[model samples]
Target: MSCEKVLALLNDWLDDELDASQRGQVRGHLDNCVSCAQSERSLRNVKLLVQAKADRGEPSDGLRNRVVDRLTHERAQGPTSLRWTRSPWLRAAAVLLVLASGFVIYSVVISGKLPSIAHATVAEESLARHIGTGVEGPVEPRWPFETIEDAQRVLERELGTATKLPIRSEQLKFKGASPTTYGSARGVRLFCEYKGRPFSIFALESIPDEVRQRSQCCFCRRKDDRYLVACWAARDLYFSMVGTDLTEGEFMAQLMAR
Candidate 1:
């Protein structure tokens, strides 16, 4: 197929709206045509972040408070002075966590393992990247850019494809973007603000199937009331977010809620 034909069908291709033959042709073209592939990936990324809806659901009555009481605290802050020092997820390493519509489940190693980037869960690594900024705290311009479009162009060059990650996903304001490594996968880490609160998002070409599958089933650090680690798979991209102080509902709304 010509680049023009492939471009016209890009959205349909992403939606899986094309028939078998058409899909194959588009896929084949994208596989061989660097320019077309970049357009496809960049458009897909745009839709994933901009058009996506949130599903954070509310926690049961008294659940939030009870969990908070059990969890201990530490002194720390984000690059923006957001107070997330509470080490709720940090307290216990192995815990059963859940979230979303009916029931969302989290896999193992929920504690402070800080596993190597190659093996760490998106949540774990996100947390480390978050707090790991060391004494200086979270700094600005980790990957400097003025607009989301600028970041997109840079990501295109870095990943060998075009990308336009949103400057704002819903209420989250784009803060910064940095190259990141998670499980042999390379992606960008975005610093953002939700209603003035700080958080980090890991947007990668792809994540491990196990991680994505587990996220579909659900994942969370239930006891750590002060902080939230969540992941979701959307189209060709995977996102892992590390934030603090949002209610169970807020967290769920970000991912698996119905």
Candidate 2:
């Protein structure tokens, strides 16, 4: 398929709304066309960005309060007295102010100021830390437990819930666990290594519906061909694993077995 045709079908292809033959054709094109492949990756990233924004829900309380205060002041002054209502430049400035507020909230989310499973920020932070590309900050690595029971003790202490670790081959060595908080919910992130490649497993008490609806049991996707993120919902908790060695299908099988 030509690049133009591929562009036309990109949305459906990503949404899995295409028929089998159409999907095959698009896949075939993506495999052979470097430009189209890059376009698809860009589109995928856009989708993830939008999902992150939606999963973040609303703006911060401080932002909302500022907006509310502005509105209240405007109400007291009345619309006729409000400069923004009469001056185009002032109206434009008001719009810019709102945009600036949104940018500030986004900056906080990306900076790891808010750690929550409902938002993508925490996941990105965890993955970055695992890969050693995390921003300069205090290292909170906790692990090398002598027994699974020991890890469970820490998990319970941090998350207020006890979760069983999935059985895995000895080739994968357990490193440690880290306490993670997302809003009012709490969870634990477990780190491991497979042949020197780092991997992470985390369990969150509340899973966003957008994530849960995407997969009945488990879902997996690759990020820039560098790593894999596999997630599943089990026993009132949401579980996710990140690494490159394990495929989504393989991860799902193990999760199902558990």
- RMSD (Cα, Å) for all candidates, in order, is 27.3, 28.3
Candidate 1 lDDT by residue in tens digits, 182-205: 554445566667557676655544
TM-score of each prediction: 0.33, 0.31
lDDT (tens digit, per residue) of candidate 2 on 83-127: 223322122223322333344356567775642323222244343
Deviation of model 1 at 201, angstroms: 2.2
Model 1 deviation from native, Cα RMSD in Å = 27.3
Candidate 2: Cα lDDT at 4: 97
Error of 1 at 28 (Å): 97
Clashing pairs in 1: 55-252, 55-253, 56-252, 56-253, 57-249, 93-111, 105-218
The alpha-carbon deviation from the true structure for residue 229 of candidate 2, after best TM-score superposition, in angstroms, is 1.5
After superposition, candidate 1 runs with Cα above 4 Å error? 1-171, 209-219, 234-236, 245-258
Clashing pairs in 2: 116-182, 143-176
